[model samples]
Target chain A: MKRTEIRLAGEGGQGLILAGIILAEAAAVYDGANAVQTQSYGPESRGGASKAEVIISEDEIDYPKVNRPDILLVMSQLAHDKYIGDLRPGGTLIADTSNVTPRAPEGARVFELPLTDISVNTTGRAIAANIVALGALVAATGVVSKDAIEKAVAARVPAGTVEVNLRALNAGMEVVRRPATGSGDAH
Target chain B: MVGAGGVRLMQGNEACVEGALAAGLRFFAGYPITPSTEIAELLAERLPQVGGAFIQMEDELASMGAVVGASLAGLKAMTATSGPGFSLKQENIGFAALAEVPCVIVDVQRVGPSTGMPTSPAQGDVMQARWGTHGDHPTVAFTPWSVSETFSLTVTCFNVAEELRTPVILLLDEVIGHMREKVVLPPPEAVTVVDRKKPAVPPGEGYSAYDPGDGDIPPLAAFGDGYRFHVTGLLHDRSGFPTNDPEEAAYLLNRICEKVERRRARLTMIESRDVHGADVVVVAYGCTARPASRAVRMAREAGIRAGLVRLITLWPFPREDVARLTAGARRILVPEMNLGQIVHEVESAVAGRIPVVHLGKVGGVLMTPEEIFEAVKGV
Candidate 1:
């Protein structure tokens, strides 16, 4: 069975843990496959560094820890520096253009998206960046379906917050898919 | 014998999923912790296919609590967690002991007092499994060195849990949890599956779940069976009511401890290879057993006549069997992940006759084969 390993890293308040859980639930429950997700958090929950990894496979997965990440999504510069070395030699790297400023590592596909800006514009929220990044990850890897991710989000999040995160996810996916590359960069 | 079919390359944690499925485990509740998340994740997907239920509870405490609740309702239940999570479940585990609930708990132990190394291996929880919870209670703990053994031992855990009317712990560590190896599933009749004995008396006749009259253990009546009885953490009499009397307290506590301790002959299981004619014995368990096996090969190749003793069951300590095996040996080397847990037991058993040297490593790294061989040098 094919296995896809994805890592989400950011400052603690960005909800990287919840995003990874939704991504894994989408793969395991909705997609009818095996999914293993594990996370490591620092002492503080809000501003300290955090990271989570989700592995989806068609067959039974053996090792849960992702020694080498196939897709690395970093929302902050510290996360990029902390985990860029753990990415596989030829892998996909995605980052939030607003907060993460580190250039992508060589020998891998790189996509820069306005995740934070899109979250602010679409939902007027900064906390929904994780779902937005997850949306971009879904669009980029096609590992888990958009419908599955939405269902997982609806299953997990509060009723009032579901629609905002779904919209943020779609907005993030759309902004990254488009080729517009000028003043909106906000750098 | 285990058949070659259902053969596939699996890690120890994945094998635990297969073993639990084969043993008729229909419900699982767990939290996603390092070294043991695959069991929860695999069950989440597979349980639905098999008409079973899988729930990811709020934390390890809730995960174990939900499993106990599910077990009381007559479902075969289990929970998987690592060292820290296992620590959190201790009080509830003691509750299960007093309540006499039959369920399985898998502790894929990593190095830690508190999150020491999330992704490394350690056998530091050996003694904890025996006495982690408060007060004295009977525990049946199994340790598997290989991926396939992990599967078989999980089934064994369920079987013993039902047979003994208590919680059975499958104590594994990160090396076995993460190591990849091929496993073969046994045929139906080859592996023995034991279910809890039902009460001989009618439901209205007052059946006691904790009643062990003459035998080491008594049958447990599942809840909702129309059997009326009280369960409490305090020491209780034959009718299962709480008591403060010293005589009743001592009787209840000793009965609980001796029920398993008295059956040590049947309870203990070990694996010994080339140990009969050896001058030195290398005693190990869990992941250290793997390298110890390799060390035996290296020592034999170098004409050192070293033998290996691997423990399949860790608690109740397997004292008699260990003593028998080391009867004539000049020295015994005990290798484990922690500083000196199991070595203490071996030294006690050898009675200062055979020099019991310890080879250990902590904080998530495993002791190497060369280090073990060095410990056996003078023997």
Candidate 2:
């Protein structure tokens, strides 16, 4: 089976690290696949666009770090500017229309979503934007099974916020489930 | 969240704390530091519930002191720290070594001469772990490559410390300390826990703190156990009393070194992969082993006969394994996170029998498999 590499990047407090962990757990813990996760550490990760990387494969993961990501999720303009070149030539690019204005790649497929707006509309809090983005990614890519991601979401999110996070997750998933209405775009 | 059945996602540091607890650790004292703080954080909440004690002491020195004191009182004790704190605790660690105290110290390594990078992973402390403390003393260190192995290796650490009545180091790089991985820890019955042997003779009837009594390691008697014995850093005789006599001092030092050296082979642990037949071998440990193994596979697929020797035991230097495993190999490559710390040891172990190539990266990034394979190709 082919290996998939994913990179999630945004501001320091955007919860991309936790999102990376949840995604890895979905693949490895819930779906019984092989996955490895690593995050930027020390000064560069703070007061700047922090980053998290995950690699998933059916075979054993050799190199732990993401050399070139097959999928890139950028939640901020700084992240897009920093990690844009790292995506494969025709890879999938998920951008947050709420903050990022992506400089379109030569042949990349892009999905621009109002992630923060969806989180606000569904959960009444913008902090769940990461979850909403996760849900949308799962819907569009089908990288892991829906059942696997839901189990991971329930297990990872805090107890009191689980219900809302799942609601936010489903709300985000709905955008890609029926994206013809314009909340999400395929360009 | 620990001791849960089946598979679960956990970080390396968290698994280490749970392992120590399962190995009957009942006391912990540490000052929090990057890369290793998670060990102390998890232990603070969990130790008390297990009827153990956890203290966030004023500093790393005090933390080591507390560990030694607690262990002397008959409780399994531990302390965790990073590079800077690790430096601070060296004197106390030396004290524990000279005193023959049974305790565990976990050093989650980071880039450093001193505080170079607080959270970036580096294996710069390899030599420090062996020689940082100020004397000719015995040291045992374990380096685990994965999270699950972190759990089991920690259990082995406590066991070895108690069995030998010596201080042990669980040397962890920052990546292994912080990376979260899927793990299914063994049931309590499956894990082995060792405690220091107590004196069989009646307390006051006949007991010498440093007496070897038919063996190299003297059975340690916990304080307040009605056995009176002295303990000090100064060279001491069988009575545990400080002695300037050259003969007694020489014997005492020899006995301590012999205790660890004699068991070095039995304590040696490693994972060999097609090493005996491969034309080229890579000797790596801890986090570095992951990529080195991958590179070995990459080499073989490309028609290069490459193998790997992943070191589980860093101290006591597995010379025999290195020489024997790579005897047929034409060349040896050593990749490490530091500037050739273990590579030098590998060179020494190989003893010019074969050309040894060194790959060292020290700016806070793990060596990529391609880079390691590139060297294999060059070799």
In TM-score terms, which candidate is top?
A: 2
TM-score of each: 0.68, 0.97
Share of real interface contacts recovered by each model?
Answer: 0.00, 0.44
How close to the true structure is residue B305 of candidate 1, measured as C-alpha lDDT?
80
List iRMS for all predictions.
10.8, 3.0
How far in Å is the alpha carbon of A132 misplaced in model 2?
0.7
Question: Which pairs clash in model 1?
Answer: none
Candidate 1 accuracy as lDDT: 0.81
Model 1 Cα RMSD, Å? 9.0
Q: State in Å the error of residue B291, model 1.
A: 0.9
Runs of candidate 1 exceeding 4 Å displacement: A1-187, B1-5
For model 1, residues B251-314, the per-residue Cα lDDT tens digits are 8778777767877788788989888889889999988886688678788898998898989998
Model 2 residue runs over 4 Å out of place are: A43-46, A180-182, B1-5
Q: How far is B15's C-alpha from truth in model 1 (Å)?
A: 1.0
